[model samples]
Target: MLTANAAAALLDTEAEAADIRTYLATQERKTLLRFLTCGSVDDGKSTLIGRLLYDTKLIFEDQLSVLEQDSKKHGTTGGDIDLALLVDGLEAERQQGITIDVAYRFFSTPKRKFIVADTPGHEQYTRNMATGASTADLAVVLVDARQGVLEQTRRHSIIASLLGIRHIVLAVNKIDLVDFDQQAFERIIADYESFVSDLDFSSVVAIPISARHGDNVTSVSERTPWYAGPSLIGHLENVEIGAEDRARPFRFPVQYVNRPNLDFRGFAGTITSGSIAVGSEVMVAKSGRRTRVKRIVTYDGDLASASEGQAVTLLLEDEVEVSRGEMLVTPESRPNVADQFAANVVWFDEHPLLPGRMYLLRTETEEVSATVTHLKHRVNINNFAHEAAKSLDLNEVGVCNLSLQAPIVFDSFKENRSTGSFILIDRVTNATVGAGMILHPLRRAANIHWQAMDVTKASRAALKHQKPAVLWFTGLSGSGKSTIANLLEKKLHAAGRHTYILDGDNVRHGLNRDLGFTEEDRVENIRRVAEVARLMVDAGLIVLVSFISPFQAERRMARDLMGDGEFIEVFVDTPFEECARRDPKGLYARALKGELKNFTGVDSPYEIPENPDLHLRTLGRSLENMADELESWLRERGYC
Candidate 1:
């Protein structure tokens, strides 16, 4: 190694200094690697990061002095310099000796520049770890030597694999605590390999190190004479992160339409994958309009070509109606355009995900109304098993089917992360609640299309000389909803009104025969009935629906399907005690005897309607009086 004084003297010549500057500049242009550290709590994740920075001489002299003093005052290493203090920068973290958020650091060696994300180890912050791993090229998962492979180790490993991390380094830390025994290291490595056999990582390497003592961090350690492998920093600097994206088909999502003047019209966005050249044939994904590239424009100047990750503007030779939220791609290779897809999602909110509730889905520049149509299963992080689930709670990973109000242009997340990933935003609060990766579009979404007709709802209603409407009745079981609805339909039919009645038990005998009494099935049951009611109203008939749709979310879903003033929610207000005492079918008695499960009034809950259009108390009233009251209200609203 050259001395400091000699190195300064060598740079004294102007020509030599210029040559050295050129060499350093070239090194700065090398490829970058993004990785994160993850493991169980107190597994030395921050210590490993601090050791890399300390051994590489990246810390300044003043910072080192402060670190030495801080070590004595607050460090957990017992009077020695606590390397972990370098990474746990937050005051709370330093005081509590834990990492709660994702901390990012930037540094460079001669071979490569790195952006390291140190994530929390607690199970509560698993969503935070997923956020860090979304864009990572590799992962450094630490395992304590004494603990060997743990449940958290498996959790982080499975998450890293799910996020498409190609490389993984198993750093068995604190080997010095075990006297650097070769047998201990081998046992940990064997245990790790056994669980990771099902993962899709291209490379998995093991290294033994003592992060507190700075052993085998940046250089090879002499303590482990039987081990032969590159150090942690060596492998990071030399690992080959393939450039497969550069070879795939070009994809550019138009973010803005730049029309500075009458002479120019350009589409501005970043090329997310592959490259584009002037005069190449391109297609607008949303409109399926083909055009040739006329020019590539950038702030620097016009260019003949642009590659992946470059943000530029392109002018088309032919006039095309391309706008924001549309995609530009090669005609020969296009992504799937569909309104329904299957995806892997990680829920991040406190409120659990309930099906049929509308949420905002944003992918790239497109934002559309979406709903969780079905929850297929949730993954068991411990053993990678799929368990049946109706809803996803906080920090749960599940495979779900999503239904969007409009189609979007996207590729599989494995092919292009930029276009294939999406997030769910709560519509009311406008908060991001979940993140998802698209697996594939459902085959039926591509095969089905709405067939248009000349005669519409307006024409049908006009021909019938009446407005179409849906009268929805909701209440607890054993209530008089079915009785009142049947009488109201009979009254409307006598008055020359087109009417149809869709009762709960009648429809369940055929349309919803396969569904059970679980909460998930209950939501689905109401959804099917609401859809059928909507179809009948579209045919210009006043439809009457009677069901004990107990959940408020399901009721809201039905109301949202109809036009304003078209859906009338009638709450048949009858107390649960009154209904249980009545027990018209003896269902509540059976539930009380432990002969029935999921009985609405006996076991399950019934969410009362907060604000119903019509609240009718049927306990002390006659059926004819209730039916006449509903008929008078419909007549006053000009429905009959």
Candidate 2:
């Protein structure tokens, strides 16, 4: 009854649907690889990524047509088709003819799916490259054949290794410019291998190719007959990514406490390592509290088991003390639990890292106050040598010992990156200042414990019949901090009020004699004075700390050490010109003539208190009047 044409059309439609189903099934099973391109300025990082996308047939005809027009407008490639435009999508990057921000692209071959990051090549953009490298499994470190291995090449390689990128592809780009000479390629490879001998890359594969033109990129090139290595695409598709994370111990960082109802209290997080089943036992890595997983809950339903990278809500069979920022792991695989540790830090802030400054240490789910206790050494990128350094400047890498306010769960970066990595945030500005990777616990953190005392602060204050507080005096040099502090202490002593003055100059002569007047030393000076003042306050004495304390960061640190409402900031506001004119100790003259350094109001800066408890204008007020006013403030608040 049906015509031949109708029957043929129906059969063809059914065949097409079957083919589409098979293709989708195959695509879903393909493995994915994440990588990044990095090197020095104009080393073809972006161009290399663009070429990969193009040679893989990911670009469209319309895109190629517009690329021709953009090439003319940008003149980056002399009116030719600029393949780099495909990945360098930012208008600023195109205008400047360089990559600035990190650009990400996705493409796929029959064997694997790829996500590649095109990172900037300039030194200032090292942070951007680091951001890209943090998640990459492999790094395609491009090098110009003519220039050979450069400083940035070495720096990127070092960072890649530090970030745990085991596989490295050294794409010797612009090989055509070097006349496809095998000797030039071999020389660059020799230098790179020699430098990276100290690094921790599992494999280093060097290939010669011209990214601008399609030579040895997707297939073997006839020009490089001496080279026998696989093409870039071939090597990437065949590179074996280890399944180490799954084989290692299980680690689940509890992101949130999900208590949807009284009937269910589940711990929700993405399993960072290994696997967990419905009946598997997990222990609190820090506390060693054991519990069993009752159910592995997901949106799709309860899973019998879950592996690494899967987000699920785990219902425990027994009640346990678990909180956010804690890690649940295998019973036998307990992680390091300590408040003090050593780490490798990459400084990103323009403000140099002051050793004693308090910074916010932010891990995966925890944040605590931490300070760099010591700078062991800074690594010289050029020669991979260690050099002594007091502070870490921008783009500098150093190893430091850090002391945290509270202990948190962690593992060494080599074992588990998610739990082992952290970022240092400036407390005042909340700006991310540095990124650090934990090496190991300090061992002292475990041995030392706080000793309990029978005499408490409350008991001491009751015995003295007066409230203990810290009167923090801050001002420019010759601005009457010491003068006012000395007068206030005398008044308090006369009134039978126990008081002590930790004068800056006097303490430096004894407690801080080893410290210099450098910025780092100044921070340490304030830190030591703050600790002493805290102890004096604990002993029921009204502690008066007189220091310039020019930087706000240290002042805030000192203030944070005190109890709420117990720390009062007294600002002695003397005009800079007036303070310089007084020059009471002749120190200002020496400072102005370059004989002295780190002198507040001359070479160093003073950050005035924005909201001081007592603002005394020294331009007109006498010392006696100011001291009288200060004593009155204490009396009004019932301190004396």
Candidate 3:
């Protein structure tokens, strides 16, 4: 109905739109690679990433304009348009000219889509570097050519290797500063390769680059014409990272148990690895209960099959004992099941990681009360040597033996990172204190078993004509904890109830003779006494435990050992000034005189209980009255 030129124009517009759609579809199908840059301070990690974003033409005009203005104000390059401003997005980072946190950026070339994390280079922020490396497929470890093979550079490489990054690109940045000397580049690469030889990396390719000037970043640099190798982006676009995830065994860590209605029950989680199809049988990792998958329900509808990274609700053919913090895996290929294992742990807390102290170890599908039973060795990341260490300090990596309260399912980190990685949480603060990768299950864990006895705790209590309980009396020295506990035990014994007392100083002479007054020893002291108390309570005796028990973590661990409502935490509330003034054993005087170390209420800290079953104040109340009050409360609850 129109002129020939108008009709041709309309057809051309439709064709152009179709071509655009096709191009987008191709881009969507391009393979995606996630990687991170890490190394020593001033290694140009941020600048290298900024160069990638700029060279790939991923920046908008407005962002470029803002960056140019920011370059004049905060850039380190003396009014030049500093490319690092593109990635150092934080105001603090720009002001300090340092990356304090992990800055993630996404960009793409025609051949591949990429996600890059620019990690901090400082030793204190090494935990942040480990976090960024946890999920990366490759690591571009930037090294300043002027400062070759620094300690932080080696440390980051170790963490990257530990976090399952098999491929590495050793980017010797700032090559221009050294006049692009081929010998200097080779020397740096040689030192780095020798240091990381034991890390078990599949590949390590070195490239000389100048991130600020964009040489050997996106394309070949004329300045480094003597070096013959693929540029950073060229190698990244062509590297072949296998689909190892889909090839591994099926592992679905159930995040939530979905029960929306009476008729429907489903386990909802993301498939961490491998493929799962409808009608495939899966087993609960810990329980070994197998069931056929009836449906793979997604928001869009039912899927016949689901692979790694897909979030869906899986309906089973039968109702199995599946819950949150459990895993559903292929029945034929089960993960390891053990309560004790050796792991490589990197401590992140300001407080050191003490052996035998209880922590909450949380894996992908399980959280359990665990302890570092032994500090095998600490890694000297500088030279890849193992050194003996009593505890793991901040940013320290150690191979340690961990024993859990119950068995969990996991694979070796080398076999599967998702199922093997875990984080340690402080019981009191609930903060993540450390990260670990499972090495292998200890033999003792698999060999030891709880041999059932004919006489149980209930039977013992029934024969004694009373209920068993652990009366944990905790306070500072000279706070009347032992005095009140002794009085309470005498009253119970006089009333014909079974009773026993585990005094702290008395146990140290026999049971805990080898331990010292260190913080770690104090934790061990409480653990041993709590175990004895539990055994006594199981033998039909009301066990009264009197100790300083300074840390709340150990107290909570002791409480966790007892059955529900069986452990009563009785806090003896007395002022530190009063305890110090009393100085019943002259311990505070010794501590104040710098003779005693780690003595509670003097040199050491005592974390007061947040909530206790009984709080007895010694300011006005007499010891006899406090003892009677505790006994009367127990009688009211029918515990005695």
lDDT of 2 by residue, 237-291 (tens): 9998857665778989999999979999999999988899999999987788899
What TM-score would every model get versus the actual structure?
0.85, 0.96, 0.96
Which regions of candidate 2 are displaced past 4 Å?
A: 1-21
Residues 379-496, candidate 3, lDDT per residue (tens digit)? 9988989999889999999999999998888999988999999999998899999999999999999899999999999999998888899999999999999999999999999999
Q: Which TM-score value belongs to model 3? A: 0.96
RMSD list, candidates in order: 5.2, 2.0, 1.9
Index of the highest-lDDT prediction:
3
CA error at residue 272 for candidate 3, angstroms = 1.1
lDDT of 3 at 389: 86
Q: Stretches of candidate 1 above 4 Å error?
A: 1-24, 61-74, 89-96, 260-264, 299-301, 349-359, 371-378, 385-398, 425-433, 475-491, 563-640
